[model samples]
Target: MLEKVYPPFIFNEFDRKNKFGLFMDVEKVIYSGVTKFQRIDIFETKAFGKVFTLDGVPMTCELDEFVYHEMISHVPLFLHENPKKVLVIGGGDGGTVREVLKHPSIEKVIMCELDEEVVEATKKYLPNLSYELNNPKVHLVFEDGSKFIKNFNNEFDVIIIDSTDPTEGGGGALYTESFYQDCFKALTENGVFTAQTEEPFIEKEWMIRAYKRISSVFNVAKLYLGFVPEYTPGTWSWTFASKNIDPIKDFNPEKVRNFDKELKYYNEEMHVASFALPNFVKKMIKDI
Candidate 1:
């Protein structure tokens, strides 16, 4: 009798220019395929359960997914006094939608995902994050987020962009200054917006550019940080921009405490404390 041999799987992410990135050992290859927009893969790792990646960039995993989803969704939602309607661009995995639905004040969420395949894959494999898509309040639409957001005028009260890296898939369109301007025009009065900026270490220059572009369009823009265990440089950033609402002065910590659902990452202290930047980061992006 011949012995059965398991296929070897390795997860690799390399910087296009510098050839510097993460290399992790994979336990199993559960799924892999190429979609119209990008190649998608789902696999198991010893450290991070089932992981989803696009074009070899880790998007989310069973472990530490809450941190990124919570920060990107809640920060902008909580900053607004009453966030009824929200627009979540990209985030086909549905983690952002899960966090957005936590707020009872959210009446409707228009999730504009670029790839329908991403939604199907996550729903089947990453149910913990994608299960919220079944909620009646969520309306999933297949289209370009940058283009779809332009159709509305004074529509959404909160616009949260859960985008993939600009270098991958169809995400580059979402990173442009015009997209931020479109998001600005799509919001109702006193609306707030937030998006996942890059890490301040390896992608410091991109992060600064994002901040400046967003700053140019919105009345107020601020950079904040969060810790994600899986990401390189250990620290991550989110840009919070608003029209006439200040996350620092106007944010009410009591609201976070009063939030009905259980949140793993975001909390009362984090609402204000996250905005307090380290000396190096402040010096890098402050004057802009």
Candidate 2:
């Protein structure tokens, strides 16, 4: 049975010093347990509907997930001319895969998640997000993503690293230089790669390190911003690295205009705007 929590559940972030708590009008703990990788909790609140937390940190919620999922999936995808084969690392919730499948150009999507428990819990508690995991075009693989991608060479046209934070219980090796090198090797020529880089306000050093490492491996490295309300400060960033494609210069505006799928957050103008980073972030990654 899942552990139950009452109203006024506190959702902590960074440290106990910075946190966001909500006193829900209605609340129910759908599932809670310690998975092999980390502690998992799925709960429903009046404000966010269904919320998924890992290691006591709120990862994603139903209300504002579209902003994060759309930005992360579409930015690199539309940048690539024909993203037929794609790999998603650590998106067990299936939101990334859901967004990726919206592109008719995508033929196969392999979602390599480290923990199957996260997949199961989300599938039961958050059906809307995890429904795409069963799609014929989607292949679910349970393995350490960093190790899984190393076996491939020039195989995927786009790689999306929807990993957790790189803190103590968060994704450790997934943020390392070695993993970026493996990602570089796994992507084909003209392939584009993007990862969920930490928020600059709270994770400045971590973001800088990721930017530098990705820049060292790929010819074109860029950073883009998204408004994920569930995350701290309401602003989150994604890092893009490409072997040969420049995300902005190589973007297909026609594809965006003619896209058949219904989109909530990302569009052609938003694509161009996402790349326009603040001066502080610009200076941070400028040297790299």
What TM-score would each prediction reach against the true structure?
A: 0.93, 0.93
- Give the per-residue lDDT digits (tens) of candidate 2, residues 1-288: 222334447344444544433333337778878977888877788887788988766788988999999999999999988889999999999999999999888999999999999999988888889999999999999999989998999999999999988875444888988999999999999899999888788657788888888888889998899888777777888999998899888887999999999999999999999999888889888865
Would you give me the overall lDDT of model 2? 0.86
lDDT of 1 by residue, 1-288 (tens): 101122344435444344665545678878887889888888788877878888777888888899999999988888888889999999999999999998888899999999999999999888999999989999999999988998999999999888886664433888899999999999888999998888788778778888889999999999999988666666899999988899989989888887789999899798888999999999889766
In the order shown, what is each candidate's alpha-carbon RMSD? 4.0, 2.5
lDDT of each: 0.85, 0.86
| 10 residues in a row with least lDDT, candidate 2 | 1-10
* Worst 10-residue lDDT window, candidate 1: 1-10
lDDT value, candidate 1, whole model: 0.85
> What TM value does model 1 have?
0.93
